[model samples]
Target: MSGEPLKKAQESAAESPRALRDLIGYHLKRASAWDLHNANAALEAAGVRTVPMSVLLTITEKPGISSAEICRILRMQRANIVPVLAELEARGLFLREADPDDNRIQRLFPTAKGREEAQRMLGLISAHEERMLAGLTMAERDELRRMLAIIWREDGEG
Candidate 1:
């Protein structure tokens, strides 16, 4: 959507009970919901969703990254990340190797096709971010990202 449409949509959300705005968490939740819905739709064509794409990109960024490392980087639990790992492996997007020195540990590395898919997904995600952030100027976008990083860091999430 264009800046005008995004602005209108945000205004519509803001029209909700003003009392809700008293808490910053409400705005975060609202923005998160909006991103979740739109990002899911944006990534649907690649048979991927936001969380999985995030995992894929993370793995792509760091080859030989272990599942434990992924859990730490993404702040995911072993149980929650298990299924996602299984799905990605089953899809041939990545492969796991036993640590040479520690066979009990498994490391993740993206396959050739996985790299190809990552590029495509990155493109899609870039376009999606462009549309979603259209309402904000470049400076506002940078500040928004910095503020969000601080929020994550405060919770030891980043």
Candidate 2:
């Protein structure tokens, strides 16, 4: 608590290998990997073959969102999404139907079974998110999220 020792502590803290920013980035990358692992495990437990979490998330959000929109929001190419879409469709998770309003557009929709699976997937996602945010206080978590969002936006990564 004395001035010199406190200053030395602060200096050491700043110089540590796990300084704040580096720690944050390190944990962020680790958490991303952990999320994917947990999601895959959860899917397996639910008797579902593993698929990309991105596809499951997109389908869950907009059951009938257009393929183009998925491509746009995820910043993915048609080539990347097509095979995944085909596999999901083949697995009876969803299907692409031409838009009645615009035949040129193909929209994704979860079948009845797909809807059920989506709900289960969401449960898994929620558990993973809860685990990820476990230690932070609510305010701290919110501030961290806000700060990260601002950083992303400023860097044109959002």
Candidate 3:
């Protein structure tokens, strides 16, 4: 393997600087990108992208949730979630109905088909999660999840 040393050198050169690697945000972003990429690819066959998948899951879990509530809970901008919601609506994944308490607020609800698709998506998500966390022990995975929850809440509050 004459090229092995050269490949090693090239990879070493491409490694992130220590300062970047030390940053929590950098690690979070890298991990987020990796997970999102894998999830998107795995769910593509279901005609669901990452954002839509998230929206669908949230809607399924919290039926009659408003778009604003979703944005707040998910830390997504209204503008960004709008297009995703529109796409989901167009695809018959969910429907917006006027809230009984406040007609001005539109509540989100998954259609019957959407509920079925959400179940399928959950299975796909579980597979993707397993693949992503394959190297980690069960304890490690649980700890990582706990750490992430702490970070998520702290970051949102800040």
Best by the lDDT measure: 1
lDDT of 2 by residue, 1-158 (tens): 44564575467557656656367676567556766777677667556534545675688679789877888777778788888787778778887789999999887887887777778777876786676566666887799889777855644565
- Give the lDDT ranking, best first: 1, 3, 2
The better-scoring model by lDDT among 1 and 3 is 1
Q: Model 2 reaches what TM-score against the true structure?
A: 0.69
Q: What ranges in model 2 sit over 4 Å off?
A: 1-27, 47-51, 154-158
Q: On residues 11-113, what C-alpha lDDT tens digit does candidate 3 reach at each position?
A: 6545989787668798678778878889999998888887788889999999999999999888899999988998888989888899998899999999998
In angstroms, give how far residue 101 of model 1 lies from its true place: 1.5
Q: Give per-residue lDDT, candidate 2, residue 31.
A: 52
Q: Rate the local accuracy (lDDT) of all candidates.
A: 0.87, 0.71, 0.85
Q: Report the C-alpha displacement of residue 99, candidate 3, in angstroms.
A: 1.4
Tell me which of candidates 1 and 3 scores higher on TM-score: 1
- The TM-score that candidate 1 achieves is 0.90
TM-score for model 3?
A: 0.82
- Measure candidate 3: CA RMSD: 5.3
State model 2's lDDT. Answer: 0.71
